[model samples]
Target: MSVPLTVCISAGEPSGDVYAGMLARELLASEPGARIVGMGGREMADSGAELLIDIRDSSVLGLVEVARSLPAFLRKRRTLRDWIRDNRPHVLVTVDFPDFNLGLAAQARSLGVPVVYLIPPKAWAWRRRRGRIVAQVATRVLCLLPFAAGFYRDAGADVEFIGHPLVDTIDAYGLPDRRGAREALGLSDSGRVVGLLPGSRTRELGCLLPPMLDALDVVRESAPDAAAVVALSGSTSDASVAEVTAMATIRGARVVVGSTYEAIRASDAVIAASGTVTLECAIIGTPMVIAYRLSPLTYAVVRRLVRVEHSGLPNLLAGRRACPEYYQSDVSGRFLGSAVTELLVSDAARDSQSGAFSDMRAKLGPPGAMQRAAAIVAETARSWAHE
Candidate 1:
């Protein structure tokens, strides 16, 4: 409603923080004086957003974990709602965290502000009816996944599928040669390098890292010359970092902090936790075995709710076994080590997975997705500001 349109962004996850930061930088490049504010992690603050809350470090991903964090979630919701009511930003941009964000959008709508949903809840994956409900809350939906548009469109929501921000993110790395990257990190340049990304949450590190390291140990026994790197993400706790580094170091793998693309780049094959990191592995054209472990009760509770064929995003987007997924019961050191070894030892196996990576990348949309997304948000937010 004014020349310097105020935009509020809510991004509570590490992946979302990366996107929010990229989007914020793009927005600032175009609208230098505009006020950008909201909830995110260090990356968003680094991009010049006035962080009202930093929930990225504390993001969780399990059925039981969500239940445990409900109190803090509620407080965050109330704070965001009160801020929207009082400050009344021209446009509200929500990045994922659908359970929390849809409510924030509802509050922004109640105050007559335009809402732009970025990487909104994937109702197609489960609870299909919520997609229809989301259609009514946000003014425009910017989808990063290719199939995401049809879901919102079918529900009669305004939606556009900009190319995934990941492409742009990865492109910035310039696709360095694997040996050169490994050498740059001071790792052995000849042997197989396995990158281990055990997710980015406290519970994820707790539940997944031990087993992932166990798998790394199994690999070390067979290919003693092989190298490994346990890559910690932005959300990892100081305790988790210490644990992962110590454990991985004992298994002959060094611990690297938070350079995901470089980690993937340096590795020949990866044993990664199932999540957005799987997509990062795929984007880097690395063969991977994806693993996820949840609390037994949480696994039992949400097992039936999952509607997709593949648990990993790379496999899910491929609509087939683009990469192997070992869930709670299926996850074992043997299976994970064998998968990584298969990719490392066999050219045929690696080639097949590489083919699927190409297919997955095609489905991921084009590069410069953040700039495109920022353009859409800017146009919508500033449309009638001068009227």
Candidate 2:
């Protein structure tokens, strides 16, 4: 009998874990005997990837947060390095978490392991230098955005635009029914509804949720019949969820856990953090206002380094400001509230924003992105066995 195929994936955050989990399941389906193992959270493990380390506790954002977690990063790095040296997995895949994953890719390359980067950093948006660095490190780069693919290809990286995984995720899960979702959230059909998506990371919630809640208060004043629903990410802590629920309850808003898409489907519009969920709302055809804040120091540093004109994914994909975006000091409940109120009450505003969603969806390419990515990853690994 020949040795069974083995692939290792490294995903350091919740969104990356989700995409990595989908890819792991696809890989297992094609090669039943293949062993998929790596560092990630419940998502990857549920998909049959054996966990070498659970990354649930290490999902920090911004430079200051990452610096505080330096010891943990070092530990994870040592563990991954040892695994690659001993197991010599046919392919080592790194998903997002650019700072950690890119370094891991370099280490894997040194150990003679071919590295495939899935959802690599947005070097095209900021830190343009990282584009060339990634080209030098990874054997292959799978990009979600067409523009990112172009940028990486131009930078000399062997790249493929597998399309945005959100399209695949939505297709796989099936979009939630508006009526059913509203009923589940205990929202009335006649009232206007606004969904609140603070973000997936704890730091994101800490920085943004208060302003989002404040915005909900502002909306309630203008549209007394409007209902609010706070959709918490699955990665959020029980304590955080409880606190958020309490806050939402006091403000007369319902809070749901693990029902983000449901809340989006149930709402006329969403007030969201500037992240993947903004794109999710766009795909689901919900008009949204995007806002986010970072630690003051991190914001100051980011302001200098980020070259992109827009922060929201919807805007980035549209190549224009399809959704209203407020950052740092400008991200306030009063501003976000006014934007949500406009989208909720003004048909023209809502129609204009939702119209842009069609163009954004068109750019994400056809579905089956994860299938394409999985095929490439499996082929890259299996071909290495022949070599």
Candidate 3:
């Protein structure tokens, strides 16, 4: 029997680490002899990939944060590039982290390594020119969202819609019973529970947490029994956790930093920053109000460049307002509190929203997407090694 080929896969954030880990597991399951190695967080390392670097070091968000971390980022980039050049793997797979991933793809292409981009950058949303750059570097692009396939195809990239991995993950977990979830989170039955998901990035926490805590305080006055919980990203720092805890305590809200799913499942409503978590909430059938704020300069540039009407994934997927989104100047504590309160009090509204979320979930298609992605990567590697 022929030995399995080596595939290098890199993912530079918690979510990317998760998808990469799932993909690695699936690839190994299908081709037991296949070798997987690359940069990822602990989850991916635990799943079997030979860890080149921990993604935590490179997972900063926003222009300012990226700028601040430039030296460290450059050092890691050089190290990975050297590793890839020396190893010369059969295939290089990049999972999101577009800014960094795109450069890595370019390096792999220069080495004549076949590149498969998983969860290609959101060029369709803002930086449309990235499409052409991706087309030039990647042998193939596998997209999670249906619309992404068309965007990349039009931009001259070979693309496939593998459906979202979130669908498969959520399906496997199943929806938690609302009451059971509340009990698990130690939430009271007499009042509403609100989930606060600022985001996983340090910059996002700095921009989002204070306002969210302020909103929770306002919410408490109107509904004295109301409780708030913060979903802490595994990537968060002890300092950030302390900051969130102090703020939550001052507001009389509970803060939980590691288990994101439990917080979402237990909440009567969620106020989240726009990103993957919005889609997760929709798949879990949680009612949510999505909001986001960027650095003034970033927002100013993005506002003009971003072509989409909806910022949240659920809303964009539905091609309608599946959830309310507040951006930049529009995102205020009062507005956020009002949105959460509306969802909490209106059972009929929640039911209708839940039904819409279910429909959206159905559109996401079947489970095992990670396995499918893994199979594709392994097969591609095998074919290349023969050449």
Candidate 4:
């Protein structure tokens, strides 16, 4: 009797879960007999993977949060390691969540399983020494960023540039027509709209949402006709959503849950927490002000370790400050409001950002990243499993 081809994927956060789902679909489509399973959320399960773990409420953003959640993380790690041992999957695919995924990769390697790391850690930006560790464990790396491929290659890791998955996501979403988007989200067409994007984690809601609302209040002061809309990320808890909704209501901002694309389209400008959402806004050609406030301890540690010139993805991809950024103490209502207000009221400001966005898109490579990554995973499985 022949053994069924097994691919185990581990994605520790919501964004990575979405990516994992896409990859799983591609893998199953190409090889219907392949068994896909591991740790992820609804997306992966819906994509036909039997998830051993559901990653809801497990995302932590910074040093303090990770320290608090260490025990839980350790538990999940142990469970996954056991699964890997029992299954002995042909290939173990690790998606982002570097701190967790990297250790898992090392374990799989010791067990003689070939490991393919998708969207590995950003060692070029911080913890450059970790690049060697990645090179040591990963049999192959599928990178989303062009620069990341170069970085991994230099680290002596086998790497493939599959381009970025967001390009495909946005292209499929289609460019939003402002009037139509406003109608869909029930925002008034007469006034300028500002979207507030806090982030996907519980910690982000506590640390960033209030400041975003404060910025919205500031926008309303300058342009009384302007309306505010807040976008809730997919991974937020029910309690956190309710709290955020109540907070937005107090500030007169309408809360929109899971309608991120619509909110981005409805807005003339946005105040967004620094992360993938900024990159999404840029791809959608929405002008934005990026704000971030890490826990003080995390900020202190990150400030010293981070080697990048820009914190926002748009700025990093554009190789310049395409979006205005305010971090830590500078992430104030006054600063964020001024930047967002300029995009809302000034044609030149909006035009400059939109123009820069086009350049960033060019740098992000073509679509079909999921297909390429899926092919890589299957090839890796065959190469290792047959041997």
**Clash number by candidate, in order:** 0, 0, 1, 0
Model 4 error, position 337 (Å): 0.6
> Candidate 3 on 237-294: residue-level lDDT in tens?
7887888888778877788877788889888899999999999899887899998998
Span of 10 residues, lowest total lDDT, candidate 4: 1-10
Q: What is the lDDT of residue 284 in candidate 4?
A: 86
The whole-model C-alpha lDDT of candidate 1 against the native structure comes to 0.84
Q: In model 3, where do residues sit more than 4 Å from their true spots?
A: none
Residue by residue across 12-56, what tens digits does model 2's lDDT show? 999899999999999899776989989999799999999999987
| lDDT of all predictions | 0.84, 0.89, 0.83, 0.88
Return the TM-score for candidate 3, rounded to 2 decimals. 0.95
RMSD (CA, angstroms), candidate 3: 1.8
Candidate 3 residue 170 C-alpha distance from true site, Å: 1.9
- Poorest lDDT segment (10 consecutive residues) of candidate 2: 168-177
Candidate 1: the clashing residue pairs are none
RMSD of each: 1.7, 1.3, 1.8, 1.4
lDDT of 4 by residue, 164-265 (tens): 888998889865699988998888888889999988888788887877878876787889888899998766788988999888897888988878998998
lDDT value for model 4: 0.88
Off by over 4 Å in 2: none
TM-score of each: 0.95, 0.97, 0.95, 0.97
